[model samples]
Target: MAGVGLMVLLLTGCGTLQRGVDMARGAVFGPKGVRPAPEEVAASPYAQLLIEDDAVSAVMLLGNDDDGRTAWFTDQHVVFLCEGDLVCGTHGLSARLDDMRIVGPNPFVDLRAIGQAPFTVDRRYDWHDGYRYGVQVTGTVRRVGEEEVEILERKRTLVRYEEQLSGGVDGKNIYWIDPATGQLRKSRQLVAPGHYAEIEILKPYRRRVQ
Candidate 1:
């Protein structure tokens, strides 16, 4: 059964935006809770992705996967793409601001501001069979001292934040962010149930001279 499920996923890729939104609404909202506005649930992050930013383009390494996946970011979300796929079919996974417990800016989170405050995280997973899973977890961030990390072949010192999640799933995710920009430098985040991915920001995408 597990093998069959894996095969289906590889063959069909991820689910559609409508399916994902439907699942999110049903799973995230209770009888008394209000449904999210349509604009708030739109899946297309392309407009934001088009903004020219030096730090928007990145590379993410899947858990123990040798192939590196290309990551694109907007002010509100980050989308990971499958290599060599068609433009419309490149989306492998995505994370949005509405799903994140940000402290400062939309995507840029302030580690110091988070301190020991508890926050809620809602992550939506789009599966191959047109199914989506909304996982809600309560988490807290704490400063874990500083560490020297290499980015784009340059070593830099960064503060480490340990994000501990409970409620839906119990796990400890690590994040290293630039204090100056509050942008994530490296992260080991939970992408799905029982699955985690290691992500490191590579050099930003440079547009070729036309």
Candidate 2:
């Protein structure tokens, strides 16, 4: 009951908009650093559509033994694709065709994509999923194929309330996004007792009309 009460107080006593702005700027540019205005970052292409939301799909061409494939709907529908029957008409159809379909709405948003800079880091607002609280903008530079790429990270907190209802959770979420395409490359969650989950982007694609 004590812990619950504390959570309620923290939520109700969150800092004002100015504080949020200061935190965002500090995280994005570090101390004594100047960054592009929040509006500019929010308006950048990096803030544009990261992936198809209304419809989604992808194929994972794993090695011979594990040739993989997938597809799903963005709205409220979910369907898993089978690898068989995918090559039915080709000469190697029998070898590559695996037809299967399981239903479930697509999972949560692409974490990496959600961490785009300016939108998450430099922006002057919070990104919530109606359940979790997300903040902190992280960017990393890495080598990709012969070129250096910059990636953004989004940190979120997941919540689960008891009978008190307004209590928040204590956890951390990290999202890795590719700035070049604004696609989510990976996502991670860390909770006390050291429980964590990671989702990696192996393949991605836009919806294709049949």
Candidate 3:
């Protein structure tokens, strides 16, 4: 929030009619820092659409796997396509990624089933940067152990996992998954070379077991 406030101070001096409203509220803070609650996400009397800083709306979930991958849009129609907690592809980002294919078995989708075991998964995606498009990236996924993380004055023990990605992009992808429900709580993934997306799932959608 301090960063945004400092930016507001600097940008406010510039003078533009629309710039006043362009400053963000719920958009700036880091995961370990101050973040909004679940209810603050949807300000409208209608759907969940309205985060103070940006034109951020509630999660606009798409259909099944083929139709969509749990997507949402923000800041000038920027869409993020997510498979569980991992961000697979993106639109409206500086360097775009498309056609993300997770080759073979993906155990990271459910840690409860896999039990935090070290695993490997390969992925292919189109890179808009110099790497070009449709290149493959190899990864070794493993549990880095558990730690206590505090969010909004609440503390929870979360298992931290790191994925060392090689080939197309060389970087580490980190994820925090809830062991009991086998759901992703938050993650930082590289959508393109040198470009990473820090995602925090304020509220996760889970299917009810009948």
Q: Quick one: best TM-score, which candidate? A: 3
In model 2, where do residues sit more than 4 Å from their true spots?
Answer: 1-167, 190-194
- Model 1 Cα RMSD, 1 decimal: 16.5
What TM-score does each of the candidates earn?
0.45, 0.24, 0.68
* Model 1 agreement with the true structure over 47-86: per-residue lDDT tens digits: 1112111222322111111132333322122344332110
Q: How accurate is candidate 2 locally (lDDT)?
A: 0.25
Worst 10 residues of 2 by lDDT: 85-94
Model 3 spans with C-alpha error above 4 angstroms: 1-34, 38-68, 207-210
lDDT of 3 by residue, 110-163 (tens): 865655577888888876566576677898888888877664346778888888
Candidate 1's displacement at residue 188, Å, is 0.7
- The backbone clash count of each candidate, in order, is 0, 9, 3
| Number of colliding residue pairs in model 3 | 3
Model 1: how far is 177 from its true place, Å?
Answer: 1.1
Native RMSD of candidate 2 (Å)? 23.7
Which lDDT values do the candidates have, in the order given?
A: 0.41, 0.25, 0.55
